[model samples]
Target: MWQRGAVTDSAPLDVDLALLGGGGAASLVLAALDRHGVRGLRIAVVDPVRRRGQDRTWAFWGHPGSDLDPLLSASWQRVEVATPARRRVLELAPLRYAMLRSGPVYDRAAEAERRLGAIRIGAPAAAVHDDGDRVVVRTGGDGPTVRADWVLDSRPRPPARPGRTTWLQHFRGWWLESDRPVFDPDRAVLMDFRTPQPRRGVSFGYVLPVSDRYALVEYTEFGPELLTDAGYDAALTGYRDLLGLPGDGLRVREVENGVIPMTDAPFPARPTPRVVRLGTAGGATRPSTGFTFSAMYRQADQVARALAAGRAPVPAPAYPRRHRWMDAVALRALDRGSVGGPEFFDRLFDRNPPERVLRFLDGTTSPAEEVAVMNSTRLRPMIAATAGDAAHRVRDRLRPTRPAPAIPAAVVATPTPPPGTGNRST
Candidate 1:
């Protein structure tokens, strides 16, 4: 813990790197540095509240043998995507859909911090300034100030510029336990569009079954605004009924909720020579899917490689400019009433191979493959959207640079049943 002290301009601690927030990004950075064999560097991780429990969950599809394999709570070989008209179960042989909880990640980070002899400052960074050669970080309430040659800031901040179309990928999940064998542990439901759709955007149900009787069920939406507390509960209740889980011996074990902004805005990785952004602020989250775990890992690895090479530790761009442009067009189509979410995603998986679609989402597919994937969607509407997005870009370039408004924060509802419910049945 950082010690409280009298206010002073001089920093009490100096290190090679200072992580502004001790969240998943900070932990991943440390892991990446260790993996890249860059060690013995003084490091400090600063945050008012570090995650220590299963406060969140992350799901991504990746090839087997990842460094995070040991920490995975569950993995599914087959992923199911269902619409009202058709349901398909696609096998991800080379790649497995995996789930990770926050608790184990935090525990691993703690061990890494101890191994590196890094300082863990339990205080919020009030201000961070890049003073030419070094970065200065001032903690809240006169806590010890820190100076570092480089800083990876994971604190929540807005995008570098505004985007043309923005939507909130908000979700609320519940851990469920039932006496009846209600779930198939081998198969995970990626998107079950059987739920009620929103008037403007789209809503879907996501289920990850850890066992025959235990699963994490969620209600997700990609829309302009967030649902109210009662609204989400009602949706979840309807979804539970839709799944046909027995109501008598069912229990809500835990709850997790969050909102990720899905926008085409540019989140610059390095704002200054000595100061770089990490996590969502660094464009780790994909504008289309709100998936950040894989991208965060990629960003951390890039930064570690640069540091190991004795170069300016700037992370690579999260996605190619062409991918960003494509995402902007798709987002515009979704924002307008051009296509329904169910049809858009249904054709995405139904037409292309599951692996190709996943690769496209990860921005790894070739131009030829990408054209095929785009052609599967509503081409006419997408083409119109592309023209509009191109015009918007040209207008921005012609106009003088001005500060764009940050993405609006969506309304987040408190998780139901609170924490510590344990295995009690409802």
Candidate 2:
């Protein structure tokens, strides 16, 4: 391994891991390293801006005894889903629909930095190159460089998006506090598809209540592009009107908005094995649902175990090949409007237990259970979608892979992928 030149001391400094970007994926990797008791290894987290605020909320259905147990800000044991004509309620016993604020996560991450003793270089890295045994990271212009035995390139994203199929899960949410008790604090609305949908995509509203008077009201859609500022406001207004939420002496406390990519582009690209790509960059994000939190955690733990075994971390495919193939079938069908999102999801929840459906969406379903879920969907449409998917894959394979142009150091970062959802959506 290449070592840094001596400056203040005689011993050389060589980082065991150089995190290309210090977002959630990189943070989780450090936590995994600490969990596995891999100490005395130099580590560096490179990013320009420190994660700030509780501006984003990450919601997931998790066990009460899991790693996120202590970090939960709010949770609901009973969940509800609705369409214009039908509604269903589900009871989650050991698993609860939970939420964690970004504020607490960032605070705990600070503690990780202190405990793990990682070097935080608050600068943007322009390029990451794998040099056989070591990966050299260079900053723009005259900035310093660091070489590490292994590099996990989790930089926000490549400059050019090359997805033959890309759908965005875009949403805007308002945190509301009411003077009177208006929401059921014990229950959360996973999806209310009673609102008007777009001409091309499905739309829904989700509510997560913190208390009887406080809840998060979100308007979401799976569409081709992100809505305009005014477009989002109009949609939120319409949904608020549909639910009569703006009245009843209610006030908006805080607001947040974000867009998540639901693409069948193999989640960007797979580069070298030595310089492995991380999280969504490595196709960890499920294309059909745009969920990555659970997958990222699993992948980080896997990488740590591989390294602890005195071997290079070769992260297995986050989703099995069959799952990826199935997702591609769904993506093409949805993008072409051959399938309706609401109808498909309603059937999925209606046919299988929510827990089973959730496991399937999380990519943890057994082969038999997966078969049952697939049986619930209309097979003819899937067959058609699969044919198109095959053609797209062929074209994508034929296309040449070009290296990304150099990113100027002045550019800080790209849009960060939003947090995972609590719903068992497909």
State in Å the error of residue 84, model 2: 1.0
Residue 372 error, candidate 1, Å: 1.6
User: Per-residue lDDT for 333-356 in model 1, tens only?
Assistant: 988979888999999998999999
Give the lowest summed-lDDT range of ten residues in model 2: 406-415
Model 2 error, position 358 (Å): 0.5
**What TM-score goes with each of the models?**
0.92, 0.87
When summed lDDT is taken over every stretch of 10 residues in candidate 1, the lowest stretch is 1-10
Model number with the top lDDT = 1
Q: Residue by residue across 14-36, what tens digits does model 2's lDDT show?
A: 68887777666777787777777
Q: What TM-score does model 2 achieve against the real structure?
A: 0.87
Please list the C-alpha lDDT of all candidates, in the order they appear: 0.82, 0.73
